[model samples]
Target: MLAKFLPGARGAVLPLAILLLVVIMVVPIPAALLDIFFVTNIAISLAVLMVALNARKPLDFSAFPTVLLFTTLFRLGLNVASTRIVLVHGHEGEAAAGHVIEAFGNFLIGGDYVVGIFVFAILMIINLIVVTKGAGRVSEVSARFTLDALPGKQMAIDADLNAGLLTPDEAKARRVEVTTEADFYGSMDGSSKFVKGDAVAAMLILAANVIGGLILGPVSHGLTIAEAARAYILLAIGDALVAQLPALMLSIAAAAIVTRVSSDKDLAGQIGSQFGSPRTWTPVAGILTLLGVMPGMPHLLLLSGAAVAGFAAWKLHQIERRPPPPAPVAAVEPADQSRIGYEDVSDGMLVRLDIGYGLVPLVDERKGAPLMGRITGVRRQLSKELGFVVPQVRVVDDINLAPYTYRLVVGGVVVGEDQVSPDEMLALDTGQAVGSLRGKTAKDPTFGLDATWIAPGDADAATGAGFLVVDPGTVVATHLNHALGQNAADLLGPDEVQALLDGLKERNPQVVASLTPQPLALTTLTQILRGLLAEGISLREFRRIASAISIAAQKSPHAEDIVELIRPDLGSLIVQKLCGVREPLRVMTLEGQLEGLLGQAARADTSGRHVIEPDLGRRIVDAITRAAQPLIAEAKPFALVVQPAIRIAIRKLVKTCLPDTPVLSFFEVPEDKAVEVVAVIGASQPAQAGHFQPQALPA
Candidate 1:
């Protein structure tokens, strides 16, 4: 059982050491071991200071706060142990406590206990008032500022992730680093109090040793006043000095860590790189030289300093004046400026978005490239709805475009062009806005609705007024999405059709094997799929489509005939897209006489297409368009149910005006679904407006 936990056993050392320190407070220790403990405390303090100085940033030494606590606790414990030894055995000699304390007492203080006392007082003031106090304040302010900046930094990370400049893992790592920095500063703020408290404890420990040792030396051990002063008082100051020096070092280390600015280089390197300029050193050399020549100054030392400063200034100046190294040249000759490669002339991207210079910030990586992320989302959504991987939209800056304008191109043709201010939002009045607003009046780029370009700050007010507000990136993205929908048929080709078949073959091999590269060629299949997409049908269910095409191909040899034969198989899919299974299908129809006239012409011609007189054709188109307007106003999906022979002719006739409205044959709708006739074309009756009128017909 222990073997499972052994890997993490290394973390137990710190707790064991802390427990030992706690024991030392109550237990008495001999002089020999006490010397080792005192030395180890000083060494730990020095090592911590060195590590603090070498850290490139505060977070680089994230463990310093915990280390500060441990070192402070251990130093206090040493003071406790050494104080016991000093009072109990001071009558013997200065070395009674330990050699480490004796050297500080006798050799450093030179038997003058008063001088040692003054030195310890100075160290205490510097640690408590100067270093520890300053570090605490810096940590407090740094923590506050770091937390305050958190929201903006997090948004920047998200923007970069969406813009494709950073991968998800890299963004996650940066977020962790930001959070750790905030935590480190907060810990440092708390840890600085440990240093302050340690300084206070040192003063108390000194007093305890001196007062306790004095009363005990003469009364308990029968020593004279002179001998007692020589032994106990000096030893007290010495022991306090041993602990006080390490405390001062820790205070300095805490200050250094909290004050440090994050950088790629260490403290010494940052200082040298920033301060080595001749601009700073030249003034230093000149000022020092003038001071050296002053009558009251120490001429020799000041002149020597001036000379060294002058030499450093000259070296810095020479380095600054040196030119950078020349870039390496390729061995091959350079191409002529006028010459161009195929990459310059050919564009591999099927979809491209070009923005003007004024709109560059929307796609600028430093600005988080908000448009790039939005474009990526548009491509992802279109790819999902179209059942094929949409080509990447290449965003480029074009100088030829006017300011704030962007153009979307599909297959080298400009499908859409519009303008949107990068720093403004569009507040669209979607038939619900009640109040008037003051701003630049414009039409919604995606749909021509009344819109105003308003500042982002006004978004709440606009929403309160029932306006739908969206950002500039959203406006551009939605425009691009709309354009892609209209041109979806152009997005598919032979390669895409083949990929579809191959994917279907993986799961439904028989269906694919019977359909493709057999009765129908790849080009014919591609054209058929394009026709379906042109009429607002998605190929998401590729297996079903492949099976339908396989069955339809058996009765029909031509691609158009196959499409007609396959309509019954795909009826459910088409109806489901237009409305839910439970919702009745809303429809418009040609009057009996009008349908027969077109049907007769369709049957008379060998070709599927039927020609009608231009005036009559115009009247028939106007009647259907007028009838469909009410359905459009209500936002209901409806189709024109017609004779199969004339459905193709009717479809081509109305396609230019009502591209999204479906033209279905009599047998296309599922038998289980209910149908509500919204209008009957060419019928002499009262016109019904904005409501469904139910009617019964022969089966």
Candidate 2:
């Protein structure tokens, strides 16, 4: 009930404390009140020192900079209040300022003003020259390095996000922490200047109080020169000592904070553990004992110190020789082999590579496995190219498989399986080889080209004969890469699409905010993006894609409709990727009769269900396959240019048989580029340059 009445009390502390500091500077404080304030100043400085010693890392005390500013202001206020009381009240007595100041002046200096002045000057020098200056320099360097490293740290977070090592929320939290660290270091750099200024002010205030007291006391109170000097100088010395001691302590605290390195233990623990070794203490003990026995030394004190060090060294040696405690054993429980649960039949990994038991050495680091490195490289390269992180490939050994076999599994189904000799290299024949190799003949596991398994030492010989040779590890990795490329659409889901939108928000926030939930849901956008990836397109330019989706969403919510509307905008990007910047696009053009036939088939398939007669579909598939063979044999890239309405239908017809070949609509080809008709699909041979013409499709 009482807590309910304290409305806004907790929020008013900072403003009220600042107001009190101002009051102390303007108001003339009595001796009793000055004593209370001086004690408070000392307590705060000590508390700050203890906190700094206990901190594990600099960020653990992120509020130190602000605390430093307030504490310095508090000390300066005390100095002003004390100086006024010391000069005006010096003629009365030595205890005029307060007992706190009088005791420091009398007991510490023993009535000698000269010694007090020397001590105050030394404290000011240590604080201003050594501690404060070093801390300020450290803060400046730390701030500069942190700002310079910000971009690289951000890129590291992006890389980890793409690699599936960090979730979205984790990545966001790390970014926030990085930004806060930069702000903290930069603030500390500027705040350190305040402490340095306070040290300078203390010295000037001490001198002013003493000089003003000597001149005023004899003239105003009718006292003798010696009497006035003794009274005023003592009071001035007391005032300076009371204020400078706390100022020095605060400076040391600040230095401790900026110089401290990050560690798991506090300062005391770190020092104690590092020096606890028997080897370290034993040498010190010997040195101390040797010095203690010297004839001219003080034997009592020196020998006592040596005895303590020797005892510490003996204890440390005993600790180092102690054996660890034995482990406790537990009773074994019997197995229940017949029990079954849902976990026993859970889904398999999204992408898994299972190898035979004989090939286990390919993944073992001790045996120099190159397969794991190759797989990591493939994932890294593909992640950059495809604009998303690929999940880790789970590689394991299967005893049921053949000794030389490996399988690539996706969604619990094996998509590709092959056999390779674990100790041999595969030499592929690209149809221009001149010499023969003595080895077992086979086809390349990735592309099904004619290849032979040969000895590793015969690699140079095979290369000299126009054969491409690769090790067994390369063979498995290439097969895995090709399989993943074919099914990249399957890896993309709502999570990946959301990541792409978040990245876009960094550059264009308005588009992502308006398009995602307000106009189009994530599921619809993911389907469209997956469709593009399935057709062998990169989503790196997702900012443009999002803008296109925002415009298309006003008319239709269908993924297929949206994709068709955006295809023209992305046409140049797609074409440039397939054909390099220098070469004209080589294409296999459909004959006039064949183009008309596909148009009729597309009209009959208005539902986009690919409805066509079996005979007609087979003829078209056979013709495209025949035309693509020559290009494949010569290692030249080509796309089949067709009418816009029939592109999707023909893609469906040939996707399963010729997965690597691209089918493009006329709009996808850039107008600035020239087209070369490499072959005619329905013709018997290559088309002549004068006989071939690419016909435009009817809208």
lDDT for each residue of candidate 2 in 102-121, tens digit (9 for 90 to 100): 99999998988889888888
Kindly list the per-residue Cα lDDT of model 1 for residues 292-395, writing each as its tens digit: 99999999988899899889999999998999889988699877989898889867888899999999999889989998888888877787788876667898
List lDDT for all candidates, in order.
0.84, 0.85
Residues forming the 10-long window of minimal summed lDDT in candidate 1:
690-699
Candidate 1 at residue 375, lDDT? 88
If scored against the real structure, what TM-score would every candidate get?
0.56, 0.84
Candidate 1: residue pairs that collide: none
lDDT (C-alpha) at residue 116 in model 1: 88
The clash count of every prediction, one per candidate, is 0, 0
lDDT of 2: 0.85
In candidate 1, position 239 carries an lDDT of 93
RMSD to native for every prediction? 14.2, 4.8
Which clashing pairs does model 2 show? none
TM-score of 2: 0.84
